[model samples]
Target: MGTRWTISTPEPLPADAVDAVDAEIDRIDRAWSRFRDDSMVADMARQAGRYPIADTDQPLVDWYRRLYDLTGGAVSPLVGQTLADAGYDAIYTLRASARVPVAPAWDAVIGEHAGALELREPALLDVGAAGKGFAVDRVAEIVGDSFDDFVVDAGGDMVISPRSRGLRVALEHPSDATKAIGVVSVAGGAICASASNRRVWADWHHIVDPRTASPAREVLATWVIAPSAMEADGLATALFFTPAAFLRGDFDHHREGFHHVTIRRNGSVEHTAIPGLELFL
Candidate 1:
């Protein structure tokens, strides 16, 4: 929630539209920000118990549900409370806390309810994984008619549309922030990257495996490029914690397109299984 977000355009906006767009971004920041005092998320969490059935914010909740099945429940809506217990509260800022050993699939602070869109157990769903991506996607949707060459980056998740030159995206090294292992060219659509090193705390970070209840320390980072930012966002989160054995080589075939990169803890790049994906490197 304290992450920095940047939006860029290759072309200048109309004088009249600049102020409007800037204002929209601020509005979005307030609505989407968890740190805001009157944030919609806070109200929702408070009112969840009284609702007919607990549910997440629209479009995102729908998207999360879809990806949950696709990733075999590796990603879930019931991870919010458990994540907080792991030192990731509403704020991303880290604080010193005693380390609690998580037994396999042990979540200490969650309750069962039918509020989740997906009928899952002990779920504490948090949309942090996809919230930034969705915010960028919303910006893209709002400005889609205005420009073809534009990019929206919330934290590290991004969506690009090329009106002229193609998008050149760099893959940040998982271990070294200033280093980049490879650069991927994106012509149109979305790209999402999840790193274990980022948003991490003292032996505890943002990434949480719902089934495992323990912080996943295997892979360092995973980058996903897909047709929609939502899909890319969800998959990046899922694959970031997904065991290597479950993934099909470097990439798995999707009904749409397949292009991705995974960086191991040791800093080696794995190209997607698709034949031409090597070109992204």
Candidate 2:
């Protein structure tokens, strides 16, 4: 939620429209942000009880479930306390705490429920992985009719206007933030990047494998392009633990259309051959 988001439009957005968009962003943060107060997710975390599930928050719960299955629980929306244990909690002005919080069981945090969405455990949920991408997608949907060509970028997750000519996108180096590992031209759909080094504090970064309750080893970053930003965002996180090939299903034929670039810790890179897109190193 600390990331900066930008909405680029070919035409100027009306002042009221801009305010409306900002309000929507704030609303999303309030619903999903565990670090902040009065958020529906945060409220659930505090009380650990049943509450009426907000319709807007349903997508997050749904996506988390899909991602949990996709990555075999490697990426989840319910790793808040694990992150806090690794010193990724609020009050960042102070040094990171060494105490490790237990990573909630995926079943405990997001088990099947017939009626409504509820947190049944002492859960601290952080949706940073794919949430921003979802937000980008939502904003794109909200503004689709207003603009002919535009890009909505939140951190590295981007939703670009559909075009025949691909948009040149620079893939940033995970270890060295200033450098580019590769560049790709995106033809259509949304692109999201997940890296291990961006939010380093006390020698620890943001990404933590829910299984080990520790930082994921190897693989600097992953980029995924999908028809939907939410899917792209979730897949980007999924690619962190598993290889790009695993994301393909029987229905996908050979390619998942999920072009991924995995930058190793040693500075080497491996990327899938995406259809209609070329990578330049």
Candidate 3:
């Protein structure tokens, strides 16, 4: 959510259309942003109680629940406190705490009951893994209502609407932003990427492994393509901890609806054989 975004269409969007998109972004930030003290998630962190869940956020909550179980707790919204302790906090302090605490399991801390999120204990919920992608999809839907085709790029995570010709996207090298490792043709759907290179401070990065309360170091970068940006974004981060095969086998839709590529610490590349993706090295 702390990044720039661009909306591409054949023609310039109407002023009202642009405004509508901006309004939606602000709405989502207020609801889910951990960086903002006034955000709903921040309020949830302050006290343990049954908080109302907006209908718009139902998909996000559902996705978080699914991802948490799919990856066996590797991906969690409960890591907000861990990230803050590790120096990625609300004020962007980038200063690690004396001791960071391991994230609590999802079931141990939070639950959903009667259209409300019940928190057993106060905890910071971070949805950076997939919130952006979900936002992209929502923005795309708004854009789609006015235009037949469009591409919504929220930083590197994107949602491409159906187009006459697909767009060719370059996969940036995790270590060197100036070099591209490969390219992929995206006709429609979502493509989301996650890497350990960005947001660094004193031996820590943003992508923390909840299991250890530490940054994930095994995989340098991961990319995923799915029917929705939310799925792609969540899966991109999950791939850091779970293997592609397990994800594909565990979820029936994932077997056919998802494709991924991962760059490991050993400088080796591992990926699913998909027609649109091409790697140079």
The candidate that achieves the highest TM-score relative to the unseen native structure = 3
Q: Which stretches of candidate 1 lie over 4 Å from their true place?
A: 15-33, 50-57, 91-125, 163-165, 243-255, 266-268, 273-281
Superposed model 2: Cα runs more than 4 Å off = 93-98, 112-115, 250-256, 275-281
Model 1: per-residue Cα lDDT over 115-197, one tens digit each: 43222132234677777777677777666667766787777788888545456777886778997766777777888988888
Scored by lDDT, model 2 comes in at 0.75
| Candidate 3 per-residue lDDT over residues 1-281, each given as its tens digit | 79889998989999998999999999999988999989889998999998888887788888888889988898999999999999999998999999999999898998773478899999999999999999999999889988988899999899998776778999999999999999988888899999999898999999998889999999999999888999999999999999999888766755456888899999889888766788989
Better of 1 and 3 by lDDT: 3
Per-candidate RMSD vs. true structure?
5.1, 2.6, 1.3
Error of 1 at 101 (Å): 10
Better of 1 and 2 by lDDT: 2
